[model samples]
Target: MNGVSRGTTWRMYKKHKFLFMMLLPALVYMFIFHYMPMYGITIAFKNFNFSKGIWGSDWIGLDNFERLFGTSSSFLRVLRNTLVISGMKLVIVFSGCIVLALLINEVKAKVFKRVVQNISYLPHFISWVIIGSILVEMLSLSRGVVNQVIEMFGGTPIYFLTEKYWFLFILVSSDMWQSIGWGSIIYLAAISGVDPALYESARMDGASRIRQMISITLPCIANVVAIMFILQIGNILSAGFDQIFNLYNFRVYEVADIIDTYAYRIGLSEGDFSLSTAVSLFKNVFGLILVIITNYVAKRLGHTGLW
Candidate 1:
C-alpha cells in the first residue's frame, strides 16, 4: 500500500511539475526564513549563554518557565495588561473594520468611495514611529493642539499619555486608526466577492441596506471574518508591541507593559535570554491552543474554519 501510494504521489507530482515549480520560491523562502529559525526554540529549554551559544548551552529543561512564573517575575501583571489591551483591540478594531468595509460597499458614489479608501489606506502605510512622534507633539502639555484647545475654553490642560485610562484609550484608538483600513481591505475583498444578485433580491424584498448587510453581505463574508478572527485570537497575547513600546513610559507601564515589551526588557536589557525565550514559548503555546479551540467552535457552529 505504501509503495502504491508513493508511486501515485510521484505520478501526480510529475503531472503537475510546472505548477509545483511555480510554488518553489515560496517553499524555499519559508524554509530559509521560518523553518530554519525554529531550532532557536531550544534556547528556551537551555541555560542560554553568550559564550556557549544556543546549541552549546547546558540543558535546563523548564527552569526558565519556573523563573518566568516566580513571584518576582511580574509575569502575571504583564499577562493581565496584554489580555486587557488585546481584548479591547480585538473587540473594537476587528468589528470596526467590518463596519467600515460594509459602509464602503454601500457607497453609491464611486469617486467618493475611492477617495475614502485611498485616505484610509494612507494611515496604514505611515510609520508607527512617525505616528508616535505626532501623538507626543499633539498631546504635549505646553504647546499641544489638544491642550491649546482645552485652554482656549478656560479649562486646565490635561496631560493625556501619563494617565492610565487615557493612555489605554489612546492605545486602543491609535491601534484602530493605524490598522482599520488595512484590516478592512480583506473584508472589502470578501464583500466584493458576494454576488450582487443577493443584494438586489434583498432590496426587492424590501430589505434595507442595513438589513442586507446583516443578512446577505455578512453571511457571505463570515468565513473570511472567521479565519481572520481566529488568526487574531491566536495572537491575543501579542497586544501591540511597537505602538506601546514607542508611546509608553514609566508612568503608564502598569497599563502598557505587555508580554512582548516584558520579554524585550529581560532579553535585551537584563540579558536573560533563556527566560525570555521561555516566556515567548509559553505565550505561543497558549496561542496555538486558542486557535485550535476557536477553529473547532467555528466549525461546529457551521462557519468555515482555519483548517
Candidate 2:
C-alpha cells in the first residue's frame, strides 16, 4: 500500500512538475530561514555561552525562565506594557480598519475610493524609522506644530511622548494610522466577494443601504472577521517591536517597554542571550496555546477558524 501510494504521489508530481518547480524556491527559503533556525530554541534551556557556541552551552533546565519571571519587577512591568499596548491595538486599530473598509465600500465614486485607499495604504509602506522621525518632530514640545497651535490658543504645550499616560495613546493611534489602510484591504476584498444578488434582493425588499449592510454585508464577512480575530489572538504578545523601538524614549519606558524591547535590552544589549531566548520561547508557547484555544472556541461558535 505504501509503495502504491508513493508511486501515485510521484505520478501527480510529475504531472505538475512545472508548478512544483515554481514552488521550490519558497520551500527552500522556508527551510533555510524558518526551519533551520528553530534549532536555536534550545538556547532557552541552556546557559548559552558565546565562547562555547549553542551546542557546547551547558544545560540549565528552567533557570533562564525562572530568572526572567522571579529576578525582578522589570519583567512583570514589561509584560504588562506588552499586553496593554497589544490589546489597545487589537481593539482599536483592528476595529477601525474594519469600519474604514465598510465606509470605503459605501463610496459611489471610483476615483475618490481609489484615492482614499491609496492615501491610507501609503503609510504602511513607510518604514517605522521614518515615521518615528516624523512623529518626533511633530510631537516636539517646544517647536512642534501641535505645540505652536496650542500656544496660539493660549494653552500649555503637552509633552505627549514623554508622559506615561499619553505614550500608550500615541502608540495605539500611530499604529492605527500606519496599519489601518493595509489591514482593511483583506476586509475590503471579503466585502467585495459578497454576492451582489443578495444586496439587490435586499434593495427590492425595500431595505435601506445601512440596513443592507447590517443584514447582508456583515453576516457574509463574519467568517473572515472571525479568522482575523483568531490570528490577532495568536499574536497578542508581539506588540510591534519596530514602531516601539524607534519611537520610545527613556522617559516613556515605564509604559512603553514591551517584551520584545525588554528581550533586546537584556539579551543583545546586556549580553544575556539565554534569558532572551527564554522570554521568546515563553511568548511563542503561550501564543500557540492562545491560538489553539481561540480556534476551538471559534469553531464551537460556528465560525471558520485557522485549522
Candidate 3:
C-alpha cells in the first residue's frame, strides 16, 4: 500500500509539474524570508550581545521576559494601550466595514457605487506617514479647519491629536477611515456570493429591503464575518504600529503607546534587543492562544473560522 501510494503521489506530481514549478518562487520566498528568520526567536531567551553575535550570546532563559514584565508598570501600560486600541478596531472598524459594504450592496446606481468604492479605497493606498501628517494639520488647534469650524460656532479650539482624552478617538477613527474600504472588499465579495433567490423569496414573503437584508444577507455572510473575526483575534497584540508610530507624540504616550511602539523604543532606541525580542515573543504567544480559543468558540457556535 505504501509503495502504491508513493507511486501515485509521484505520478500526480508529474502531472502537475508545471503548476509546482510556478509555485516554486513563493515556496522559496517563504522559506528564505519567513522560516529562516524564525531561528532568531532564540534571542528572546538570551542575553543578546551586539559585540558577540546571536549565537555567541549567553542563554539567560526567561530572564529577559522577567525583566520585560518587571520594569515598573511600563509593560502593563503598553499592554493596556495595545488591547484597548485593538479592541476598538475589532469592534468599531470591523462593524463599520460590514455596514459600509451592506450600504454599498444596497445601492442601485452602478456609477455611484463604483465612485463611492473608489473614494473609500483611495485612503488605504495612502501611506500612514502621509495620513498622519494630514491629520496633524487638520486637527491643529490654532489654524486647523476643524478648529476654525468650532470657532465659527463659538467653541474653544480643541487639540485632538496631542490631548490624551481625544488621542484614542483620533487613532481609532483614522485607522477606520484608512481601512474600512479595503476591509469591506472581502464582505462585498461574500455578499455577492450570497444567493439572490433568498432575497427574492423574502421579497415575495412581503419583506421590506431592510428586512431582507437582516434575514437573507447577514445570515449568508455570517461565515465570512466569523472567519475575519477569528483572524483578527490573532492581531489583538499588534495594534497598528505604523499608524500609531506616525501619529503619536510624547504628550499622548500614556494613552497611545502600544507593544509595537514600546518594542521599538526599547529595542532600537535603547538597544535592549533581548528584552524587545522577549516582548515580541510574549505578544505572539498570547495572540496565538487567543486565536486558538476564539476559533474553538466559533466552531462550537457553528461558524466558519481560521483553522
Candidate 4:
C-alpha cells in the first residue's frame, strides 16, 4: 500500500515538475533559514560554552526551566503581559481589519477607496523605530501635539507612555491603526471572489449595505478569517516584539515586557544563552500546541484549517 502511494505521488509530481521547480527556491530558502537552524535548539538543553560549542556543552536537563519557574522570577509577569497584549490585539485588530475591509468594499467611489487603502498601507511599511520616534514626539511630556491639545482644553499633560494602562491602550490602538488597512487586504480579496448575484439577491430582499456585509460578505470570507486567526494563534506568545521593545521603557516593563523581549534581554544583555533558548523553546512548543488545538476546534466547527 505504501509503495503504491509513493508511486502515485511520484507520478503526480513528475506531471507537475515545472510547478515544483517554481516552488524549489522557497523550499530551499525555508530549509536554509528555518530548518537548518533547528540544530541550534540543542542549546536549550545544554549549559552552552563559547569554547565547547553546541555538541560539547554540558547537559543541564531541565535546570534552565527550573529557573523560569523559580520564585522571584519575572517569567510569569512577562508571560502575563504577553497574553494580555496579544488577546487585546486579537480582538481589536481582527475587528478593525474586518470592518475596514467590509466598509471599503461597500464604497462605490473607487478613487476614495483607493486613497483610503493607500493611506492605511503606508503605515505598515514604516519601520517601528521611526514610529517609536513619532509616538514619543506626538505624546511627549513637553511640547507634544497631544499634550498641546489637552492644554488648549485646560487639561494637564498626561504621560501616556509611562502609565501602565495607557501604555497597553497605546499598544492595542496603535496596532489596530497600523494593521486595519493593510491586514484587510486578504479579506478584501476574498470578498471580491464572492458572487455578485448573492449581493443582488440580498438587496432584492430589502437588505441594507450593512446587512449585506454582515450576512453575505462576512460569511463568504469566513474561511480566510478562520485561517488567519489560526495562524496568528500560533504566535500568541510573540506579542509584537518590535513595537513593544521600541515603545516600552523601564517604567512600563512591568506591563509591557513579553516572552520575546525577555528572551532577547536575557540572551544578549545578560549572556544566558541556554536559559534564553529554553524560554524560547518553551514558548514555541506552547504556541505549537495552541495552533494544533485551535486548528482542531476550527475543523470541528466546519472551518478550513492550515493543514
TM-score of each: 0.95, 0.96, 0.96, 0.96
**What is the Å distance of residue 295 in model 1 from its true position?**
0.5
Ten residues in sequence with the least summed lDDT for candidate 3: 64-73
* lDDT tens readout by residue for model 2, 1-307: 9999999999999999999999999999999999999999999999999899999999999988888888857999999999999999999998999999999999999999999999999999999999999988998998889889998999999988999888888889899999999999999999999999999999999999999889998899999999999999999999999999998899999889999999899888999999999999999999999999999999999999898
Query: Can you tell me which runs of candidate 3 are displaced by over 4 Å?
Result: 1-12
Per-model CA lDDT versus the true structure: 0.94, 0.94, 0.93, 0.92
Looking at candidate 4, the ten consecutive residues that score lowest on lDDT are: 64-73
Instruction: Report the Cα lDDT for candidate 3.
Output: 0.93
Candidate 1 C-alpha error for residue 20, in Å: 2.6
Error of 3 at 23 (Å): 1.9
Candidate 1, residues 1-307: lDDT per residue as tens digits? 9999999999999999999999999999999999999999999999998899888999999788878887545899999999999999999999999999999999999999999999998899888899999999999999899999999999999899999999999999999999999899999999888998998898899999889988999999999999999999999999988899989999998889999999999999999889889989999999999999999999999999988
Supply the global lDDT for candidate 2: 0.94
Model 2 per-residue lDDT at 32: 100
Q: Which tens-of-lDDT digit does each residue in 155-243 have in candidate 4?
A: 99999999999999999998887778889999999999999999899989999988888899889999899999998899999899999
Report lDDT (Cα) of residue 20, candidate 3: 100
Clashing pairs in 4: none
Candidate 4 displacement at residue 128 in angstroms: 0.2
Candidate 3, residues 3-75, lDDT tens digits: the string is 9999999999999999999999999999999999999999999999989999999999999887877854799
Q: Model 1, which residues run further than 4 Å from truth?
A: 1-12
**Model 3 TM-score (2 dp):** 0.96
